[model samples]
Target: MRSPARRAPRDADSLWRWATLSPALLLMAALGLLPVLNLFVLGFFDVRWTDGGSSWSFVGTRHYAALPGDPLFRASILNTTLFALGAVAGQMLLGFALALLCHKATRGRVFWRAVFVLPVLIPGIVIGAMWKLLLNPEFGAIAQVFEMVELEPVDWLGEASTALLAVIMVDIWHWTPFCFLLFLAGLESLPRDVYEAARVDGARGWQELRYITLPLMWPTIVVTFVFRLVLAFKVFDEVYLLTGGGPGTATEVVAFTIYQRFFTEDRAGYGSAMAVAVIFLIFLMLAAAAAARRRVQS
Candidate 1:
């Protein structure tokens, strides 16, 4: 009777499931949640190292207030925005074109695909350093090419005007391959019959692309755009390596600004404030992208 102890009570089953998942939940709380919470707390507090290596107290929103008056911070925000926009636009156009070409190519498709993807496999640091050397005004191959064309050698990393552009070029060279691969995958996964039907309808290449290809590829394009936006917004390594945020904060993206505050100035609390601001901005962007995606899907 009693239905075999009623399966040891359904409450016990729920407890057992909770117990099984506790470790993972705890791990996430420890590694992910705690750090974010700590950063949030630190952002509001004033922490500075002493000669004896001890630290200090709460300055409330002092750092946040100071951000608006900081010229370098303003410049960094502008540079980051420009880099994200330029990189996303350039990569999307080039990637879409490469994807279409690959889709239509009848010979050596695999080889061409491999060639297109080669830049993605290179390490970011190596790409940065390579570009740094290659853009050197004195003996770089690029300088040599300019010389051949009877043009004056350009100081790619020397001046503020050219430094950011140099970083942007390096980023584009490395990341366009990623966008191209994503676009190629999207193109290949589309229904062939649709294209065949379009051909039967006497649609020209441009017409087919505009009407059929782009419409169907919007989701993939959106994904690539969001990813690139996030990455480009957080760009640090190449800018750090190539320009060191010089000539005088011209190429300093937000990440490098935070790094300089945290490591060089040892203002951990201020750095945390900047970092939290960055996180907030990125979250807002991602939320907007998600909303747009949902609208498109609907």
Candidate 2:
């Protein structure tokens, strides 16, 4: 008797699905992957503008090496980290408090929720301009209030010491609403039965929150934290409009530095290198966050 023919494997279905999704995959590759590849390639080249025109020369990792010793670059990195940490910590704390309050409140909850989220809906540039006017030492409302209160008016964006803090405050004001919304959603989605069961076991509100609510909301908190962290690292528009990386290098973030190199100095290749570095740092942060999340989940 002839041997029975072997059955074909089911892998063809997956292949067909991938084929159907090829357009989207190709678009992502072109828009995302291609630019990243070009960026990496350009980072190795030195572009120089001469009297006649411009030229590119292979410079290996020269720009990367130079970055470490560059005071402005170092300051930018430090300031960026500080800004991210301060903004994220402050927003998360304040947001969590607001979320809990709003979730528990019986009266005017909708109004309070709308009030909290209004800042997040505002444009970044507009927010920057508004804050700049409000913080201006000359005729700013804040300065006027300080004068009336017998307190010296602060030049929020005019001093290196206060410029970073000013921007950090603005970021917190704009982003806390986002964290509050996420926390509220997480709280509302939690099963009431779990809390009831805890109460049945003689658990107080604090105990139930500590053991059940926080544990249940851990994933949402992680997601929000990572999202905010990434956005904070790449902050630029507000900083640019608010302080312009002055009164010194105090508010100069990594993104601002990259912009300066790319647009102001016209050092496209060096800016590309900085962009690659930022991308690498982001990947590292994401990896660490993933690892931490897994540890917590396990």
CA lDDT scores, all candidates in order: 0.89, 0.93
Q: Give candidate 2 misplaced runs (Cα > 4 Å).
A: 1-13, 49-54
**Residue 261 of model 1: what lDDT?**
91
User: Taking the tens digit of each residue's C-alpha lDDT, what string does model 2 give over 73-122?
Assistant: 88999999999999999999999999999999999999999999999999
Task: Give the per-residue lDDT digits (tens) of candidate 1, residues 188-262.
Answer: 999999989999989987898899989999999999999999999989889888898899877889999999999
Candidate 2 clash total? 0
Q: How well does candidate 1 match the true structure in TM-score terms?
A: 0.90
Best by lDDT: 2
Once model 2 is optimally superposed onto the true structure by TM-score, how far is the C-alpha of residue 250 displaced, in angstroms?
0.8
Summed backbone clashes in each candidate are: 0, 0
After superposition, which runs of candidate 1 have C-alpha atoms over 4 Å from their true positions?
A: 1-22, 51-53
* lDDT, model 2, position 156: 87
TM-score of each: 0.90, 0.93
